[model samples]
Target: MKTGVLLVNLGTPTAPTAKAVKSFLSQFLHDHRVVDVPRMLWCPLLHGVILPFRSPKVARLYQSVWWPEGSPLMVISRRQQAALSEALDRAGIRMPVALGMSYGEPSMATAWEELKAAGVGRVIILPLYPQYSVSTTASVFDSWARLMKKERLVPAFRFIHDYHDHSGYIQALADSVRAHWELHGRGELLLLSYHGIPQRYQDEGDPYGLQCHRTSELVAAQLGLERHQWRTTFQSRFGREPWLQPYTDGTMQALPGEGIKRLDVICPAFSADCLETLEEIAEQNRSLFLAAGGESYHYIAALNDSPGHIQLLMDLVCRELA
Candidate 1:
């Protein structure tokens, strides 16, 4: 039976420009899973106010972290796709692995077409988000549903929901931390930061925050980290509405004054380094922490395309195939 894998990630702008960012954000923010506000109020506010004023500023943020080849997210995601394919080959599995972005280029339709063209009779949807949220994972599901509804010959498919406490994933995270400590020595505090969703979402039964805590706890256990040695926080909150807190910015700003002078931060929610991990945590938060009296700040890179991470992905696919 022909089988294939569809690796999906939150999308990125095609270019670091207001025009492009606006287009990207329009589709991303408009998703009901993302912004639960009624379209009557949300559409005008999103287009007339937010995008008009925010896109240029956001475009600059994208530019700051943009790789020469493309956005960091897209570049890292592509590398991950290639690495996963190689890992599957090593495991004696021949399958086409294609990438789909939830909102933009290399879209779901394109990825689905690639697999269909390969004569795949079965497809596995592997969303890159390890800790699932309606905003991320569900959005991918919504896109898939839309795609399949128009298909007369939809392939048999399965979706991997969340792997927050996957043993290999925790080990890979722990290994990365150890390697970083080996090079730069250990920081006084290790912060596991994940992207934040609105508090209402959690109240509405989203498991994202809970899974993030589980991921952090598992990694901390794997690394033999004491309670005081590590912490968990949330980042990339949008709008004025409350989000899952210990807001990363506020925590970073307060930590130094609380006598935590040196810190190491890692974003586990992101499988690949992107705007949030690269610019927001590494550059912006680093500066914020330093300004607030932090003496040392280190942002650990994500597990993007690492050998261990590839192995983990391959294991996930193999498990599903079995």
Candidate 2:
């Protein structure tokens, strides 16, 4: 049977402009999985207030991390696609790999078409999220289901859900931290920062937060970190609603006062260095900690297209294919 792979990530704007960001936000926020507010109230607020005001501000954040080629997320996803394809080929596995984004260009539909054209009869979908969350992984699955519903003949497919505690993934993450420490020296504290979800989500049995904590614990154990040397926190919280606590920004602000001046922060939730990791954690949080009396802050980059990351992806694919 001819097999193929579809790699998906959260989409990005075509450009770092207000108009582009608005368009992206319109689609992204409209997903019920993302914002559970009833449309009667949410629609007016989103269009009238949130999008109108947040777009310009978010556009600026995107601009800070935009690469000359394109948005950092899209750019890194492309590299990952190419790297995984190359790895598969090296293993003598002739699997066509296509890239997809949940909300924007080169979408799931486009990737499906590419796979169909390649004559794939079986496919594997691996969303770049290591941890499963309704907001992210389920959103990607919903997009795939919407596309498949319209198809006359759906192909055999497998979706890898929540590799958060995958041994290969944990090893790769630990390797990155070790490399960073070797180059810049170890910091006073290691902060494992993940994208935040609302507290209600956890109450609703969303295991995202738990998965994130497990991932951090595994990585920390591999690195032989003491309990006091590492911490897990959440970042990129939106709205005023309470989220998973020990908020990254607030923790960063307070860590310096507690004499944890030198810090190393990593976002295991992100597979690529996007606006969240690049601008929010690396730039914004770095400045916040520094201004709050932090002596030094190092933001460890994401796995991206690293050889180890590629191996991890390959291993995940192979396990399912087998």
Candidate 3:
């Protein structure tokens, strides 16, 4: 049977320009799943106000993390696709692996077209989010469904919603944390920082926050760390809406005053280090911690194309193919 695999991630702007950022934010913020306000109220705020006002700042933030190659999210996601393809090939599995981004370039439609061109009879879609939520995972599904609606031939489909409890995924996360501590020496506390969503999402029955806590607990248990040694917090909150907490920046700023000097931070929610992980956590948040009297602050990198992560992803893909 001809099979194909598609990997998707939240995307980055095509370029670090206000025009590009405006276009990107227009699509991103306009998603009803993302903003949640009615079109009547949200459209004016997004296009008239937010896009005009916020685009430049957001563009600058993207610029801070942009590499010569491209956005870290896109680059790392492509690497993941390559690694997964190699792993599957070595395992005697023959399937074309295509990469897509939910919001930006190499879109879901393009990925689906690639799979169709390959004459795939079956396709497995793996959104690069370990934890599932309506906002993230469901949005991907919505895109997939929209693409298939106009297709004359739709392949048999399988989607891996969440792998938060997967053994291999948990092991990979634990190994990364252990290796970081082994090299830099253990911190006074370990902070498992995850991307935040609005509290309203969870209140409406999104399981993102709960799954994040589970991933944190599982990784800490694997490291044999006590409750005091590690904790989970959320980051990347925007606007005035209440988001999942304790907020990462707030926790980092408060930790030093609470006598937790040395700290190691990891963003479990992100498979690749993007602006949120790089510029926000490693750079901006580092300064916030240090300025607040932190003695030492370390930001552990995400599991981008790491051997263990690659293996885990391959395992998931193979399982789907089987």
Candidate 4:
């Protein structure tokens, strides 16, 4: 059977506007995996309160980080898709790879359509999330499942659940950090911040929290960072529920008091820099840390289409095909 790859990511708003943000959020938040609150209780609150109020504010945030090409996430994801395809070509591998967003244009179904049109019969779904959460990776699986449900000829599939501790991934992350430190000077503390899911999710036996810490430990070790030099935290939490602790924002505020004046932050959870990493970590969190008496804040960019990252993707694909 002819094989193909699908690179999946959580999506972005089509435009940096209130209407677009609302539409994106409505589909995103409405997902059962994301917001497990009972639909009966959540529906009214989501539509009547959150969407109405959050959309404009979130749209403004998106606007702050919007690129001329598109939202950073969309643009960088496309670059990744292209880079991986080229890498496969250079490796003499024959496979069609397509980009899919879980919630927006070029959606997961559309990606499948592209691969199918390319004469693919077996699919490899590689979600961009390094740490698997039902809220994220499983949601991508659900998209594939839905597409399969609609098809008369169901495609054969191989799914990658996560790659949080892959050697290549860890090496790529460490290299990115080393390069950043070389250019900008290493900070006193290296903060590896990942996106947080609700505490309850971990409590319910999700391995995401554990996988995130493992990824942090592996990358930090690869960078030769000592215990005191690096720490892991979580960010981009929603809905006021207790999220994985040592929240990035709170830690940023507290680090200055601990006399950690110089700090560097990186969001390894994101394959590509998005509003969360770019606007939230780079801009807002940096301001917060500085305002609270810190100095020399730097946000290391994500491994988006970088050579090391592209190599990591190439390795994963080759290994799977082998």
Tell me the tens digit of each residue's lDDT in model 3 across 101-145: 889889988988898789888889999999998878999998999
> Candidate 3 has what TM-score?
0.98
TM-score (all chains, Cα) for each model: 0.99, 0.99, 0.98, 0.99
Q: Global CA lDDT of candidate 2, please? A: 0.95
Candidate 3: RMSD to truth: 0.9
In model 2, the worst 10-residue window by lDDT is: 59-68
Error of model 4, residue 223, in angstroms: 1.5
Clash pairs, candidate 3, are none
Cα lDDT tens digits, model 4, 157-210, are: 889989999998999899989999899999999999999999999999899999
Q: What C-alpha root-mean-square deviation, in Å, does candidate 2 show against the real structure?
A: 0.7
Clashing pairs in 1: none
Query: What's model 3's overall lDDT?
Result: 0.91
Give the winner by TM-score: 2 or 3.
Answer: 2
Writing each residue's lDDT as its tens digit, candidate 2 over 40-121 gives 9999999999999999999999988889999989989999999999999999999999999999898899999999999998
Q: In candidate 4, which residue ranges exceed 4 Å CA deviation?
A: none
- What candidate 3 gets wrong by more than 4 Å, as runs, is none
The true-versus-predicted C-alpha distance at residue 15 of model 3, in Å, is 1.0
